[model samples]
Target: MRSKAAVRARCLSYTGCVGILVLSCFLISSCGNRRIVDHIKLIQSAGYDLDGKRVRSTILIGDYTEKEKTNIKILSTESVSSMDTMQRQNTKSNQSLHTGQMRLVLFGKQFAKQGIGSVLDRLFHDQFISSRLRLAVSGTNAAGLLSSTVNTHDTLFIMNMVEQNEEWGNLPKLNLQTSLYNYYGAGRDLFLPYLILEGGTVKIDGIALFKDDKFATNVDIRDAFVLKLLTENSRNGSILMPLKESDALPDDYILMRSIASKRTIQLVSQEPAPVILIKIKMKVSVREKPEYIRFETKEDISALERKLAAYLVKKAEDFISLCKSKQVDPIGLGDFMRSKSRGWNEKDFQASYPSLKAKIRIDLKIVQSSLSQ
Candidate 1:
């Protein structure tokens, strides 16, 4: 038999060996569990297109290891859903597809018009997908637009285009969070930036208005700009109001710069139908004008401001008329009424919606003249 000291030492050695074995096993298990980012394909942008019973999904994956590379690998597949497409794509690809880097998700026009309830639900349920991803509606097929060689890589290209516009362009800041709210919230709807392929280039065509999840109609960028001004507290955009070409004028238009704008929507009365009043105050400057107009004279300035006010009132009325005709409210009129009135619900709002009358008042403040036409 061994001495007591020797026996103790032997027991310690055995315990040490066991500990080392356990540590090694734990490390190997952890290594297998964690995903290696470098090995996986990072999806930067993706588009969803629907063709009857099938869904066509296209994604842009860039080689992260490659520096300054423009061309990206495009992976596309047709399946029942976006998640199904991903599973199928993974089978075809050696690298696992990752969506942590996805910034934009676009829907083809047809897909949008068909309604995106089920698709959006799937996306919301996806644990790996970011809900903050920007949304847009493509005037053309989303897959075709993503596959086009307009830019070496359309992911970064499209992201930059949309981001820059949100900053300086005439668009309200809209993302997945706001979109979800609009969709689920009563008396509200979602509007996404509209994109189209123009002359071998992708361009912002207009705004796609959605009544619930289904596409209602599209307003070109010009009208959308005005809509934003009316809804948002302050915005920047330019509108060229045509001054009829006459013998005295060298140019036939007055380019008005939108320095700032303020709008107030009031629920005036519920008599007969909901009577709403919209008050718009605009601060503008003359960016360009016909040579015939005199900027130095106060009378002339007042006349120009009046002209702007009158034009805007008519424009606003026309916009509201269009909304009524389409039976779609992109202006959030329902929400406004709901907030102000008691006992207002979907049924009540629907009854009053058809005969909803609106009065628009516009006050234009001309600030400065950029140049003498």
Candidate 2:
């Protein structure tokens, strides 16, 4: 038989084991959350430019905690690669560089043309970095993009502009994670916002389409809206589209506020000639109308809807043809084909992609007029 003292000792040992396990877990969790925020140099936004075999990186660090004051600093360096450039940038920075607060990462046109796989691969592997980080291609010098005068020290000014546009304006939904998904995922390519410096101010130039990981070309911001409608799930945006003279409206210009758009793509055939049927149902508002066109009748409104649908059909068809010619599947037509077919190969898909027939049908309506929602 065990003595009473032996039982107490065993109970104390079990309690000690439980306490040790609880303490270990607390230490592990505390280590995971450990951060010296004040000591870390949080890069707010950064840009990459390629010069020959070298890379130029520009980082923006901003502190705007003080009332009506912002401390802004711009650091740039050229190196063999983006990771190396970051290493060099750390030396130039007053504090240890960290990407915990990164909002935007811009790649210059030349850098994008060369390829962004290495830089992006490194960033993607960095588990500490944000998956929702915005990525853009700069039409101007990447380093020069942030050299302009700014009102706020927080890099939020430039980043907020793009974010707000994607949220409420014409830009599509895109970020580091989505871009990478399209890049690595089969049957679909990637698209990113293109930024250009205009008169010392940065503006969203268009949408940059990628043939794999390399930059292909750009779709104009206006056309980007159409692409967004066709490819993405978005419900709000405005397009100041120009309508030529029609039986209903003799004017050549009109404003369209997009309310909703739904697209249906079907791959009907794979042999002889590949054929895909596309249909888009879109609702828009007439924000501007010319006095030259008298809209006194319901028939007139119907005519306007038909005219707008026709115009959009022509534009969207042209855009799709352009993407086909460039060998880019930004709309994931190949993905749609894969979903429909039993077995598909990349070689067959590539060979048959450009020749694929795209038949479009647009059902459009003017839902609102004169800011009446």
Candidate 3:
């Protein structure tokens, strides 16, 4: 029989050996899967355009020679499907193309109108693709925008532009994950940021409304600001309001900047048809107002707030009317109704959507002022 100390020593040796074996296997597996950043082409951005019956896909990849410097490579190919287009592009690339680091994907107006359901589905199913990828619709052609010589120095130019607008400008917050949720989930249609190239420069033009993955129409950035107000809380979003004559302002225009906002949707009366009353309470600051109008008194401020409220209500109603006319539900009113009502039928709602009554009420409060003297 072995002594107790000797047996314990043998057991400890065995455990150490097993641990070393497992660590060695892990290291080997990790090495096998290791990808050299310099050798692989990481796609930074991609775009899809409709080219007659086929699809024209453009991919932007950045080649880094050192830590800070990068060279952008643009490639274009045409195929029946986006997947096939990518496969064809890979053949032309010197190194293996990877999408793990992809930041944005753009769809041309024509391509988006044709329907991006299948293409979006393919992206959602990809294991390496990020859910937070930014997706947008080009006001013109996506291929043209991607292949443009403008902003070639920075591969993330378009992405950063869109991001900044969403953060401080009038654009809404959106990403692939949120888009996919709205697209796949019931009661709401998908909407994307719309980009247009003006004077060889890319700019956020508006918001594109979608009807079942097909582009329906677009609203200008001002209207997009209104849409953002209805859907979510907005901060630092500015809009130029046309002041009414009754407001007693010398100038017809005043720029109101949203400091914060909160909205409530009430489903009023579900019989026959559903009526929605959307109430928005926004805290705002005057970015630019008529020099004659002094906000020193509470009554003066109250009058200005009332004027802003009336303008906002009119704008919101007009926008809702536009959505109803186009048969698009970017506001997700149906979803809100569905949450309130039991046994909601999408078909029934859609049928009555055009005639569905909605009322907008805005309560604007002036929290600060930075008027031009």
Candidate 4:
């Protein structure tokens, strides 16, 4: 019963409603796209340093399209805190500085030696910074660590090397997230593996140990290898063990495809010069039998085990000696003491740790022999 004019009017109103609805949806989606800022260069590596009153942050910008290319941009601002510096950076940068993809956070040797607790507290509090990002101590300035280049087999090269090492477990991977956990956790000392660029390759020179907030000392590769075996459960790796005169090897021996490890700690006396008992268990497979020894008996295996036990005991003692000399509780001896004996003050606990006597016992059991004559 509707007339042509009325029907036309109704049709027009329906069409208008449909158009309005479509426009609303388009507006919402367009707003989403508007918020997304492109051309923001991704930062792969970052270095931080303290300059008088403010902190200087250096970021490495990489061209994703051309994997071979990289550029270093320095962002400096005088602010009361790290967050303030970041806010200032946002105003100057054309592209938003996103830290979701950050891989390496390098601390200058000077800053590390002094103390990193304050700086690290700020880093861990950031919402954008990943907890799992790799952390390293630079032998030189942090800026040098970010800017230095290493040429290697791959096209992407150095960046690829870092990624591969982290993924394959060939090297110790310590990140900001793991560092914070170890730092705050009681009875656990934190350690970061140091990286130094040398002869076109990045080498894991040693480990940097921390006592409270300061750098304790640099443990060499030999000590680090043993530490790795002791702390971690996985033991599939290679190491070079010194050959003794009575052993079968010529001058020195190299162990390949071997796994070594052991860990045991005990609380001895409570008063009158408190003592702690530490036990270590290790097992190594013979990869290459040295020319100095002729073997084919059970006695050989037992003798090798004994030799390995003695070697481990000596190494453990050496490490303990080094720790004692530094007056650094890198082994979490303080934590063990606190756990065993409650109602202990931090100040008094630290004071007592210097003279704490540690008795270490090492036991080596030969599990398998890979050498075939």
Candidate 5:
């Protein structure tokens, strides 16, 4: 009954309405696609190991509830690729697997000994994984380490241990960025703290030495303490030395607190030998007073300083010997070479590392002592 022009206008209006509806629907669907699983399982820690030709990945999952408590779940898979393994895991779970909250990545002894470059490359290339996550080597099986329960003062005990270690300066802070940097460094060697489960408690055991993506050996906690003192400028810990005047000094241990340390390394071309000269200056506080010695004069202070210096120098020499024996460069010798020399190659440098002689000198100063008696 309407005119032809009016009918055409009405049809155009209807078409416009249809287009608007389609646009609204498209927007809603786009938003829906963006909505992944709401209750996603977040990985707190992960471990990697070699299982035949494939890599075995284990993830320690955790979730938070209204009560503010953590519930942990473990998921593991083996596949040719880490991504593939993750995808397979997603199929088995009702919620999506997320590594957004990942705190640590552990490598098994065998897996690390074999080679970790491929696995580490994959991690470095992943976008979802954070570069700030801490890296550690398991003292035992990586999978077992993650799965074992730890009891501590805090609810999330394992997480607390790592956080405290960083805050207290017990071990060198290792994150994904540090790991990648070490990977590309001149010696292609990296050292990570080893975590061991003992008496249902997790502890930072020692330093795990790595060479070109393979685990070379472990330096005990005592050795790690010396290594940290040598490399880092600031340290807050106790060291035990024998008392001066006691015939049976076995009962006496002087606890020295490191205040400051300066380390300098230089390469020398001496006759019939290639040598690296290391000079260390350290200031320490005497925390434990020995029962056998009376601190009455400057001469006593000088004697104590000399003794401490000798002890530190001996420890450093021992560490250098251990590194040569294991063929691992944890002191950043490669870095030293690369920084000092223009045309230094890692391959040639590593070959010469074992026989390379070292000259270490330690100058110690006693800043303060609580032992006045």
Candidate 6:
């Protein structure tokens, strides 16, 4: 009894209602894939070690059954590849192992030495893994260091150790994203925090130097500070300078803590290879100094600043020498040159890198003489 136009309108209305219902259904189904915390095991930290022909992976997961606190559970498995290690670990775990919350990944020294290109590649491709995830090199083997953290809240302890050092201590900032860029990108090599288990407690020992993807050597924390100064803008990094006999002072050493630092690199020449000049300008607080030194007068402050500047320039040069000897480019000098030069080739750079001439100039100012006061 309805008119033709009215019937057509009614049919369109029904179709529109059906479309809305279908969309709602689709959305609900998509969200149904949401996982509950209780049903999935979230991996907070993972470590990889090469065991002869296979790779061993150690994972730490938090058990949240306790009302007041979360306890850690350690799970380890050995397999041929990183993906297989995960699959094997899942077989052992009660719930599915998820790396969505992973905060740290460590490679054993031996494993890192052999090469970590494949592992780094896998981490880069993983959708759930965060770019901020911290990476490091273990002192010996990852399993040993991880086992030492059984009772303690190992995950947060190690994560905070590396993060605190990078922010306030001597370490330079390095994470998953930076490591990937340095490894995959040309003209630079990657470095990572070197962690060693000392006296049954985990401690950050130094910075692990790398050539391409392989671990080349380790530099102590002091040298690491020099590297940090040259590579990036730094703050709150402290170092000790042992005075030479020629410099007459009551004390034998000066402890300089960086308040802020800036580094500038310039390509001076390129015809006979590259001649690079690095200028490091720093504002530092003298935490420890000779008692005989006086900071009350402008002349006294200026003299002390000159001595500190000379010391830092010498240290920076020594660091550059070591890197050149090792054939490593952690400072990305090559990368800088590549940007400036018209036809910079990696092969040509490597051939001429060992004897590359670099000049370091330091402009250090003593903003605070706490020891003098």
Q: Compute each candidate's TM-score over C-alphas.
A: 0.85, 0.88, 0.92, 0.76, 0.82, 0.90
Best by lDDT: 3
Backbone clash pairs for candidate 2 read: none
Full-model lDDT, candidate 5: 0.74
Residue-level error in angstroms, candidate 3, position 368 = 2.0
Please give, for residues 46-69, the per-residue lDDT of candidate 5 as tens digits.
888777767788877665553656
Superposed model 5: Cα runs more than 4 Å off: 1-38, 50-55, 79-83, 150-156, 242-250, 270-272, 369-373
Residues 1-373, candidate 3, lDDT per residue (tens digit)?
A: 9999999999999999999999999888887556789788999899999989889999898867767877788988889877688789999999988999898999999999999998889889998999889999999999778766335667777888888999999888898898998898888999999999888878889999999999999999999999999989777789998766467444778888999999899988887878899999999988877766787788998999998899889899999999999989998998988899899989988999988889999988998655333
* Clashing pairs for predicted structure model 1, backbone only: none
Off by over 4 Å in 1: 1-32, 245-250, 369-373
lDDT of each: 0.80, 0.83, 0.88, 0.65, 0.74, 0.88
Candidate 3, pairs of clashing residues: none
The TM-score, computed over Cα atoms with residue i paired to residue i, of candidate 6 is: 0.90
In model 4, where is the ten-residue run with the lowest total lDDT? 150-159
Q: How far is candidate 3 from the true structure (C-alpha RMSD, Å)?
A: 2.9
Q: For candidate 4, write residues 1-373 as lDDT tens digits.
A: 9899999999999999999999999888877434343567556677666555556666665544545654345554446544565567677777777776677777666667767787678778868677767777766566655555422222223345544554443344456776787788665677777667676446667777877667778887667655655555435444556765566445467353335555777888978776988776666666765676545688976877677666766776787778767766556777778888878666787677667788877666656665455
Q: What are the per-residue Cα lDDT tens digits for candidate 2 across 35-123?
A: 68877778888989988888999988876567788787889998887768878998897778888789888899999998888888988
When summed lDDT is taken over every stretch of 10 residues in candidate 1, the lowest stretch is: 242-251
Model 6 ranges off by over 4 Å: 1-32, 245-251, 369-372
The candidate scoring highest on TM-score is: 3
Q: Give per-residue lDDT, candidate 1, residue 236.
A: 71
Error of 1 at 266 (Å): 1.3
Residue 263 lDDT, candidate 5, scale 0-100? 80
